[model samples]
Target chain A: MVAESARENKRVLEVKNLKLHYLTSQGAVKAVDDISFCLNRGETLGIVGESGCGKTTTAVALMMMPSPPGKIVGGQILIEGKDIVPMTETQIRKQIRWEKISMVFQGAMNCLTPVYTIGKQMMETLREHREMAKEEAIARIEKYLAYVGLSRDVLKRYPHELSGGMKQRIVIAMALFLEPKIILCDEPTTALDVVVQAQIINLLKDLKQQLDLSFIFITHDLATEAEVSDRLMVMYGGKIAEIGTNEQIYGKQGPMHPYTQRLLKATPLLHEKVEELAFIPGRPPDLLNPPKGCKFHDRCNVVMDRCKEEEPDLREVEPDHFVSCWRCRES
Target chain B: MSENIFEAKNLQKWFPVRRSITDLLKRRQSYVKAVDGVTFSIRRGEIFGLVGESGCGKTTTGKMLMKLLEPTGGQMLLDGQDVTHITAERLKTYRREVQMVFQDPYASMNPRFRIRDVLEEPLLIHKVGEDHQERLKMVARALTEVRLQPPEEYMERFPHMLSGGQRQRAATARSLILNPKFIVADEPVSMIDLSTRAEILHMMKQVQRELQLTYLYITHDLSTARYFTDTIAVMYLGRIVEMGDPDDVIDHPRHPYTMALIAAVCEPVSGKVNRIKDVPIKGEVPSAQNIPRGCRFHPRCLYAKEECWTQIEPELEIVEGRHWVACRRYKEI
Candidate 1:
């Protein structure tokens, strides 16, 4: 069914049974285990989880930087149905890294070289990935900068001279300069203030519409995920708990996965006033030695005998909505 | 009748920027007016939130309130008595009444010391308890109050042993150990994850009600402010652009800056993606050292007029019931 849907819409990226494990001295830390998803063209899929749930690790693995001590133990990452997991470093660096897919790193404003001018840093990406000449790269940078609301004079200024918002916009412009089909934005507006964060969100939306870009926006903020995402994936202990449209996940169709419901309740939504926020008790399970069955069973309010003994599989409960809870399945 | 427990009358903190050798050669002096003339009051047990983006002096204001940093101008009163320039002997009394909880949970507590020693140090300094047994009881009580139950289990653990949420709760326990009447909680929950934020906030509110403690809740997140604060003051470039009830100020804001801030919050509910139609203000907040002349927010204000440019800076004036705004054309806008 998923493959049929993928063929109907132009699937930009697809991951099947992807597993990433860190070779720690204690044990193999299953950071991302058996996760699968497909991103349609021009669609935004938001991956949200608490810290240590492997959201960022998945982004890093997708970037092809499964560093030493960390390895992709299983599964295929196909970009336009072409598996890039087996591709060598040189092949990935030359053909896949920036030309096909790129990333706007988390806290990326700090990644810019303080000594170099904005133009130089941006030009380096264009010349490296696209192999554009000096004048052409400069012109391209200027145009992209304008698209993100930066002036021409900003090209001459150093990283320290510009504000945080300006620096973030410059980083985004560099990411889109290659015209990549897929962009992995890992918490792009985490450190920025509210109004400035809005600007970056608006800019991303506009650029996505204009370029027909597919995005995997990774954030711990559920509200922000709802703003830009067509579908939302909730991950817990390196496994997906639930995946659905924004409406279905926000209690529109009644009960969801207990973890998802608790998360939506815990998050302070804009303009919504509540007497008290519902907090999910217990810490996220340790990845090194996970629980026997459902990772969230210990913290889940509705845990049953079956939940503690058998792991739930991700199954479609409704149209395009998948959940991994026995209770949800029974309902 | 509600009584004001703490009041700040136009507090100011101006730090002189050290002139570079090259700039000194040109004979120029500059100062970053970090907290310029901020004023607010906390009732006996209500939470007065000081909210703004970074560099807006909310942290500096909290520090000034805690007496950790002395203000360059203005006066502070505790129970109708001036505490700003109180004598050293009297300042000790003020310290007992007012305490602070820092933002970074890891850095706030001494890592080497166990949680028991950390909580007991404040009692030792103020000589609150007569004997070691008494201090231990007080520390255990504080721990239980913060919901770190079976306090004995956590007393011997170091800061590194606890999770971010646990460390923050321990920090809150440390603040409560002093039995302070007022606490300056500076971005206390911003360092923690969303899953743990609600618990910390709920604990804080519970403790406030039980202890009758006033809070100077400082944070950059408006949503948290709305959920936590009774009244909020929105700061912008070293000045408070708006101050009123959190619901009123956040929902029906008069100032353009406040409107922009409310618009910026991303609601998780669907169909509200394009709710914020126009960018109320243009560009990031200007440098505090070079605040615009007429209205500090005018240069970026969408409703800015000719008077907003050439006239003197607008003073904060009350336009409605308990709602104060600093824009000259606030009424018309």
Candidate 2:
């Protein structure tokens, strides 16, 4: 019991059996299905998958603000021993959201209002959340802006006045205004230019260390995710296909999950020479009516007769390395 | 005909910016130098990549090569013929030999048109086949060539009905229907899924090799450019700052801009997590209308000296065999 408490202390956020479904005209889209993971303090967990693979959905569900038609069907989202799943919407907004966890959304640069100055918009967020004076809030905003390598003058400028990279930095600063210990970044650097992307990635790393914050960095770009994540989680359809440290997933031993291995192979590399890039033959599964048994069974290169009949649970293949594959189970 | 299939010499495309009231009163005119004096030659059947970030005018260069946009200045030669400002009648013939594949397949194709109609429209425009039946046969053949087989099945489907990768393949098939000698593929795979990007690129590569077609592949992603192209030219502020083989340009980039770009690429290799990546250059790219004097990159260059901006802009000088850099301080850097 004492050991379990110590382990819980290290985890900043724990998600157990989290299931999110989107009700469409066709059917319920299982965007996130029974996924479980724990994010340790100051550790960055990178979630990678193709479009509609539930990377962004997972982030949104954690924030407890899944868009209309999307509902958190079942699961417990525990932050520092507090279960947020049972909390009401008003209660979650007041106590849970932006207090313990915050999110930097995909293409958040465009989220800034054009009518308001950067300072005014940031002040509104602070004013909505806490009882703070304008001067104190402005000072906090400036400090966080500086943390993201932006100058004080930016607060006076409108969203259109700044470049995409600068606007992204401002979004990051806004996420930090509440001083949340955990930040969920969903494709934060997706549309930015390469150089600017590197700068943003570096800034996130610096802030992670300085603030001692944990991050759920989600992106489809495997390389960028690999550059930021301490532990990598590869998701397919709506389930966790594989989860492990960078070495266990990307080292010479290679990824055990067929989907993860194929994804890594398909991604183009700069520093290495590849004679050919392997591509997954089929399209990503439609969540509305995903294939039977394993979600990735249709695209798996090393498929077995058993894989088609029974779904495999996420089993620990090595120490701290979990893979969901019937082949791994046989081995 | 010359061995070089298509050559662009000091090509320039400057779009005039709207003059303000003060500028009009002062009789001042400004231009967004989109493609400012870019010079390169595409060898026969070789893939030459034009790589740069957005607003760097790579797309403008591709448009000029395709004759979609008339160049404001400079010469464009095709098969030893100067065809920069060809007559409309001549352009029709020229376009038949030089096709273009755009970035977004969804936006590029007509939504109402079937796959058969999309491929047939080009053949009809170029007057390739004899009749309707003959054209349909050619369309089926083109579909087969792109490996969208059993061609008849795909031919009846609309663009929306097909998947992203399949739509791209259909787009490629449309471009190939006319059997163009030169193709300008501008960020063709950027809109597709990550897992399927390699498939599109591989099919494009296979088609390029089988048909012995020359391609001007334009993209902002260096990794894809490195994998797909035979030669690469790194552009900045509408100018070619570096040009050489993919190995030389990507592996041992000489220009400061190229070096910074390569450094910024997020390599998928493991064990690089949490490592602080230093993006050597600073500040965002300046507006194209207000390009810096002398060296266009001096504003953001880390090693910029007084002469870099004060002196005359450096021209592309041969560093070694087939490797060229426009940076004056390349040797020192």
Candidate 3:
């Protein structure tokens, strides 16, 4: 779906030569290493990676949320074809933040104030966007809650009264309250149960269509990401390892990178059982002093001599699919 | 049934909650049914998973089995002894028979104690602290039993000193220190990182085999449930909705709720597969305090009819070998 629309409007968000680093006492930790990609309007771009791959930092840089110790050393974040990385905090706050693009922060259940009622919390966002009476806001809150499939009574309860899933629903409701064109949700359902997680995933997919909302869903769970995302961008050590549709990103389009291939074989699905799940042996590269040639050279199974000495830039292997692995060309 | 090591009957735990400050002043209280009537059994060397979201009372069930939190009602017969009506002497005798692994490895182990002190404290409490040298020897052996290699390095580490996996291994060493017949591991790996989560699961499976420890592993993760558990029990709002072999329950989930939960988790098989628009069950998990009259899952269930509302509760009927489902429409599905 994203490939079809790529020719239409180019992309709402164009990330080019984006490099974010954590300036630590030990030295610069290149969290998001030289990543580049673009996202079309109303398309779900699922970013999959483990803990410290700069995926979260990518979201922070795009939203201009990263402050202090963590610095965006190099990058151009283009929203609506306008570069946003170098914008001051004030311009981003008044013009861009939550107005053009908004984010449902990771672990949103804890995002709500435990003391306030849901109604008051929803009104906080509503008041920031537009001037409305308390009664008008209350009625709109009930309507938005209904859109997220929750009843009006949820607004009457405290954050402690709501379950983890309910708290997530409220977050989605808040993300949509201002009705920004693009929404970024980071590991939205990690704390929820499986059944409740399913509900949240379905809600986002349905809302993506109904509201014509664009979403950048970041997660470690590749299975659910495949279910919801139109296109997927696989990130490793802050670089774009692969970018393609779900069919291309998942095992379908031949994975040029051994890391992608190994990750595909390892994840445990619903029906199948294995004697042992495949593990991508060895940890991710230390960002401070990363490997020289290919970033994946250490963990790659079919590592060639050339892969050890030369880093390959991301290029089209097939039609729409792109990979940065040196061995990809041979494959 | 042949491997059944721990059997529980009518397990119940009730917590009294005062309605308000005024109600507390008036000395009025009402029972919050944290864990209502529940019953299940776990097999020897088998990972019997109890899957549920929070407030479904699965944790309460695990606590009741361990006798950590005193149950207001019910009977627990471990390897054949009724632990419901036991005294301090009897409890001390039963202490070595049953052991529990808590959720947070960080908080579970005492912050003040070293790894050896924490493990050997149980042995000491049960009056096995006499042979300090031999207990130290057993501590090293217990650490190895749980797959923590070269136990000497781990002996001096406190709860804060080690990684999550190592801390959990240290905690498991504490549990296995007594060489208990049954281990109620209540979300032991929940707090660990995803990378080491599997290592802890693999290590627990090995510990189960090496020590003949029967495990009632409580978790919210279904893929691990499918991978590790021999039998699985899907709990909802303090009741078992489905119970049977893990393959039977996971593959051909009889209950709608079980099917939804499995679908929610259980990633699509690794391949460039066509995406299916998942119809995530639309609704909130109704409060345990306000359970629906008939089927607990009726509120969000797609196939619910009027009969599912205010009528008799569906009894657990045998569907196939070792498979029991508590829903009337299971046959139709």
Candidate 4:
């Protein structure tokens, strides 16, 4: 959460001239193109986008999760004034992972062992990173379980025995056991029920305040993101289309980017149920052979000649509110 | 006589405890009540939603309705015929008439089977059509019925070739080939993207209208179920806490569980931050193994009084017209 609170301090993470490319057989798919941002300590930076928008890929890069077709060809991830890209995988895993920075992954259910009990699994996590005796590890596990509102008895049960919400709690407990500086939550509450999702969201908020950790919450669901995130960064086709505070992103009448607006409108809510939400009108641009100029230009309704001919750069119109669009004429 | 296409009068399906090390010594086998005294009827040509959280017995209830699972006690009637104990000819008839559409579209369709093979397997199993060419024509009709058009293109392609939405449509087409009277759609569109969700939902609606089909849509998501289903039965820990018109349950929830569910989805009107405690209720779902005393939701329920803890399970009573809600606090609401 330090990365989140650093807004007042000026810089927690400064990514200057960032460029992530996927070295596929087809071609080098430029995902994160010259993206730059600073996440203050204890602040949430919500990277909202459609699937395959390089939002998730960027997170993986931040965690340095193995470069397959994807490679961070150029970028600098300065967390608490330290560069991560140049660091070795082993060093990142030892020093940075879970201790310095941790993440709650999307489609992350596989992280939990199906055979092991939630508590036992949690105890194992504590035992691994922290040099605690079995007794002390068990005590800490129980404390974290209680914090997430799961009983110590639940730790004895298998992963399959517990519900999705329960398993997610264990993951959260694991994320917090070491007290990481920045927590990257990738669609953390996607599969769970709404009621349960609320509980998880609240738990994150409470944990953030108590831990004073930074969160780079990655999610497609705008409603949940808006509820938790302090600031928002909208990514499209491997680029930051828009960036601003939470109120600026959600509280606005509409989004500056067409993609952002489509996502906001597409989701169905309880009270504001409309017939057929206006979609962006096309699938997400193919990473391989992506549309030239603006990746979203193919589907963007308010398209312009410049948008098709030249890619839009991230430009600041208002203070702290950054957007990328050739036709970003709205003041 | 106009019979309820599906009826469960006092239906209960409690899984008996197996003989274990402790159980063998104690000789007191504990039964896990998966579906306790669920009573509801799906009318012909109506979309009925069965919604609940995981392990709340919504899937179990649907499985029982599909006759994939036998009931521990009570009976199931399909068009005045008792199906709970059917065997031989009657069982085959019931199987042919009723079908199920599972949640995972990818798993539901056999990866090895082509789209044509997938849709035709049901027909081949039931021996519905006389000739192969005749069956092919019917498959085309089924695909068209589900709005999966230019049927020939989809027919030859394997399950892997199809997108999530298309594969789900193929799944619907497969179920439709049987010409079943009732279909239990267990969260059919939950796995797909939000953009294509509407098309699948609308297709289901269109198919239901054309085929005059009755559906038991089991899902945990309520926001879209409000727009999709006609009636909804909200389940909590193997029992229907509230059952009513979608509008009533979605808007005016009688049970606290249902209320909390609504509050969970309902965004704050004032745009002020959402509080977890203001979540209309509290606490995660209790373990299915050790259910809470009195009402299953009582442990988390805000209005849980002393009487709520000791009382036997509440009956599903008609709190209002066609709306059956089982709660001690229904009167207070």
Predicted model with the maximum TM-score:
2
Clashing pairs in 1: none
List DockQ, one per candidate, in order. 0.63, 0.77, 0.36, 0.37
Candidate 1: stretches off by over 4 Å: A1-9, B20-27, B86-91, B273-277
Q: Is candidate 3 or candidate 4 better by TM-score?
A: 4
DockQ order of candidates, top first: 2, 1, 4, 3
lDDT of 4 at B84: 85
Q: Which ten residues in a row have the lowest lDDT in candidate 1 chain A?
A: A246-255
Give i-RMS (Å) per prediction.
Answer: 2.1, 1.2, 3.2, 2.9
Candidate 4 local lDDT, residue A176: 79
* Candidate 4 lDDT tens digits, B1-333: 465788888788888768789888988777778887788888888999998888799999999988888899888888877888777787787877888888899888888988999999888878989999999999999999887779998899999987778888999998888888999999998887665676688788888998799999998888778778889999988888999888878777888888888877734222434344368786677766677878788888898888788997777788789777788877885
lDDT of 2 at A275: 68
Off by over 4 Å in 4: A1-8, A26-34, A107-110, A114-166, A273-282, A302-309, B1-3, B266-277, B289-293
A225-249 per-residue lDDT for model 3 (tens digits): 7777778888888788888777666
Cα-based lDDT at residue A278, candidate 1? 86
Q: What does candidate 1 score on TM?
A: 0.96
Candidate 3, clashing residue pairs? A33-A238, A252-B272
